[model samples]
Target: MTSLSDLRRALAPQPGEAGTAGGSDRPPLVVALPEGRAASPRDLRGWETKAALAVGTSGSTGDPKVVLLSAAALVASAELTHARLGGPGTWLLALPTGHIAGVQVLVRSVVAGTEPGVMDLSTGFRASGFATAARAVLTRPGPHYTALVPTQLARLVATDGPGLAAIREFDAVLIGGAATPPSLLARARAAGVRVVTTYGMSETAGGCVYDGVPLDGVRLRLNDGRIEIAGPVLALGYQGGEPFGEWFRTGDLGRLTDGRLEVIGRADDVIISGGENVSPTEVERVLAAQPGVHEVCVVGVPDPEWGQAVAAAVVPTDPDTPPAEDDLAAAVRAAVGRCAAPKQVAYLPELPLKGPGKVDRAAVARTFG
Candidate 1:
């Protein structure tokens, strides 16, 4: 099987003009990893044709699917990103290369004509280990950059030392993969970190928006409050002709104001409880603000009375002394309203994670809701 290390060779120019591959109908090249669930790569003949990568999503929301990306799509995404984050010079591969975010790092490095630096992530992400890797790359020539999830960014922001400093040194540090709380972003900036909150998914090759602004050649629109995206970075479609039109309709719900988008939450994540629409994300945001509430997820549970009752699965700061149910409920009610407040609260040691860092809402409902 071919490895991701052969990306440059796969894209090596033949007799074609710039921006297009030499010959059309060339078989798709799969970038295989030495290990992982997709470690044993099989030939999907003629799948990509002009594409060189096949990255599987973590499928935090539902069933995971493999997204097909073309060389033009990945190249466009990388160029757009570099334009926004200062021309790419050096990048640290702090994420899993099997995923789009990490794969884009290597692709961006290839386009920048530089080598992408990597850190060992198999042992679990750690601030100390991240610090060492960042230090090694900081000494390299030219500007530096890295991409990370909110959880990793939170760890670096909470701790002090080389990890925090190394993070601050980067020309840009992209935070995505899940919704980032405002408090976390504020804290990172307060600590002198250049945190750029990105919004996109494997379908878009990686992140196509920088801090609520869409990248050039990218467009965002709302269809009955659902987010729809159209851009050059759009993936060809899911495997087996998933049937994508011009615009990709995202499952997210959002609203636009003054030409900027404000993503509320997932469209399906809305809960109808007692005749009122309850946004679990809104409830979780308020509850997370309460003291002792570390991480929180709100879901709807079957209830004879309300049809679907509000339920909260919380990860408390101190498992020994979990936050009082009454206090947590009061906080949600205070910030949102009584209708949105969770009727039942389950305090767990930690929240269940899917893929990278997204909370597994379905698992949370099955276990606690």
Candidate 2:
């Protein structure tokens, strides 16, 4: 078994190359973490041959830790993805190179013997920038693919002109990083964007499950009301934990029925409110469908009456015009039901997302408290 120290030694760059100015000294290493789920580690010298990435969880729902993976696992994942999407295509690095999804784009390109068009992420993800970058890259491209988080996908779909136009031209867009609201996917699809919803984390080497089905060599099962994953795509294990073999236990509460996986959010994130079990992902999904709610997150706040009351944080589509809370609540209750609806709705100019394109649910919970 490859130890964490062994991985670090194998992949991290040589000593002389480590401090080079602006060199690929720190080529991103993908890591799947317990809290953040997927991340791109800054150092890769210790993992040069290590193809699988272990991402750290964002801790929006709880504490975070590292998960390990292998190169063979990554190859297995990418191969399955290529088969599912017709075949591997030229990829676009639109996201930060420090996350599993973003790193997979780079790794997939390498595996396909193709170079990906790199996008500048320092200024944050902008629809206009995406248009400009894509237009420049697509000028000399073949079949193209890009991976994006739900927040980025929502913005591109909402934007008119070049933004949405660029998205439509992509052969495929893999959306993951978090639970993508159904409404957002519908909007993107309505605008003629080919969106493939993804499920998998760093432990799975980016995304092992596309849409609802596991990729080649990947297996999914529900153990004790929680998601349990196995197969070649599974990560080695966390840094100091047991060597992961057979099945890696996932904190996510989910069930498999008829070979389809239905995610019900993290077990720790679920809130018992007013004698009813509420999954915040469900509420966020319903609220996202409401008008003017461009991005949304639901958190359970301490309530005297209901053990933990539901509250929502929203980023409206129109910055100048915000919707009324009552109307937003009404929409969610109507869509998801009053029993599962948010008790309070708060609007913000933007959701407090950490890193590029991922929502920071941890920060959202703090704001409500």
Candidate 3:
């Protein structure tokens, strides 16, 4: 495991050092490792030499790719985040260091010249453990900040214990790595949590859009319903792919409403059932609002009748008293459309997650198999 101090020293520019994407004397690429994994050197034959860090993609839909990020991009993201959240302060690391989200936490703390309180995720994230970490971070200074996935936020909110109370003390809590349910966001805000929804990926240096708005020096535009981002925060490119041009075409389908980005779903995630295109995100949104539904993942499953059928894997508020399958289907049918209603529903204690907060749709689809 690379220590936080090691990362900071590697990322920080030395005296008279030139840190740019075009710089000839670039530092060795630092690979972010997942929890419990030892660091190892990778074949860097075709990788971008100017990149400062190499973070792996979650591969929720396919095989993971290595994303190369430059020092300039990481610094820009951290500075913009601080400017957006009213200046940098102490930060807490609640995510795995292997992911871009966790790496950015360390980067921001390094930029702020502050030590971050790290959470022990070897045993997995728990509200009790988070509360303890939050207590230690809060004791340091003002304008405290932390980043988390929606799943972590949900746990803290559900616990309603010292965890939830501790979360309310932070100046900002950035939620990303997946689409957040509006109901969950509402509940967190109602409970006094300063939750800021973020939308970005490893290719964009973690998050370049905060609460639907692009960060400073970041530009966003929609092309044929697909989200395209261009800015300093953008990554150099995938390790083996061509360097990004003016715009990085994101796989997410989104639309801008009054200048704010509204992500619909993944471009490849749309389900075609009976010749009608149904967005799983829309169906999931409807199902999430239904009473007794805690978390839900809508996926397309192969069906003999409809060619493809909409299926939902739901994590109920109470495992013992899961929501009625027909009721959940009816909710989606009413809110989205009849064709969007889930034909199959599976109840679980929790939705299977890939990466940080993203639900594993492929696994959810497999549940119907």
Candidate 4:
């Protein structure tokens, strides 16, 4: 009858317990058995291994996989982050702890020897709720911090009161969970919110790249345009116990320019429309920046003439003044090319969210398919 709290401690490797891949003389660390329900961690059985945590991945795709994280990996991630973002500090837990992003908040707290101020996600996210939770976080010593999805940050910026003010005071606020629109980033920075866009997932122990720059000891490469990351912070492996090799190849498509990684979109998400490869993110970025658009998700749907057609699901800022389909399509055409223009547009109240507030591309595609 091990409670989740006790399991967390048993899984947390003690000092000096973490060593290089196969050279650690210490007995294997926690196996991190996963239970979606209450009271996890049963018999060690054949699961005993060198992993400290088990996390699940999130993407636009419906498929999600469990990733195994090592103590060294998590420690390296937190240490490198502290060095980059002005050292460890108090953190407000605004995300669900079941995900890697949420798990890292607690992990960073442990590394900093502080307790995190938890946000009541059971009641859904609200500016008032975040503001109240953030106030308590700032009361602690050291630089106050918090991580959130773009939706939460956008809401804070829109609210423009205690929530935005509280955000302005933090040393650094991490925004991840999905691709953040540049407009949103501009808006956040304009309000004096130190929003840092993070890239990585459960496979990388949360985010290994901060603001498009790889953290210390982390490396990035593009294989045939797909992102492959290698670093101390990389996850050990998946469940069933197959350890990763030198690098973990991600589904993300991106390029490196002057050592900075620029994530484009998912490689698998490329749309072949009328024999041209259309990047959904490129279209979405263009359409989202339009005046009336609040948020947008672009997906390729089945088309008779072109085999596949580019489509966009938009959330208009003003429901009464929804963006015109032609304007959005023209914008995309002007930016990327005609091949990237959306052939179909669906205006919605909000884009569908997958786990942890990421845009659910599959669902969006199904709606417009």
Taking all chains together, each candidate's TM-score versus the true structure is: 0.91, 0.83, 0.95, 0.91
| Candidate of highest lDDT | 3
- The TM-score obtained by model 4 is 0.91
Per-residue lDDT of 256-342 in model 2, one digit per residue for the tens?
Answer: 878888898888888788888888888888778878778888888889999988899988888789877888778777877776778
**Candidate 4 C-alpha lDDT tens digits along 150-266:** 999988998678889889999999998899999999999999999999998888988889999999899999999999999899887876656789899998999899999989998
lDDT by candidate, in order shown: 0.80, 0.73, 0.87, 0.80
Model 2 TM-score is 0.83
lDDT for position 345 in model 3: 92
Model 2: residues >4 Å from true position, as ranges? 1-55, 334-337
For model 4, where is the 10-residue window of minimal lDDT?
A: 37-46
Residue 102 of model 2, lDDT score: 72
lDDT of 2 at 321: 91
- State how far residue 45 of model 2 sits from its true place (Å): 16
Question: Which pairs clash inside model 3?
Answer: none
Task: Please give me the total number of clashing residue pairs in predicted model 3.
Answer: 0
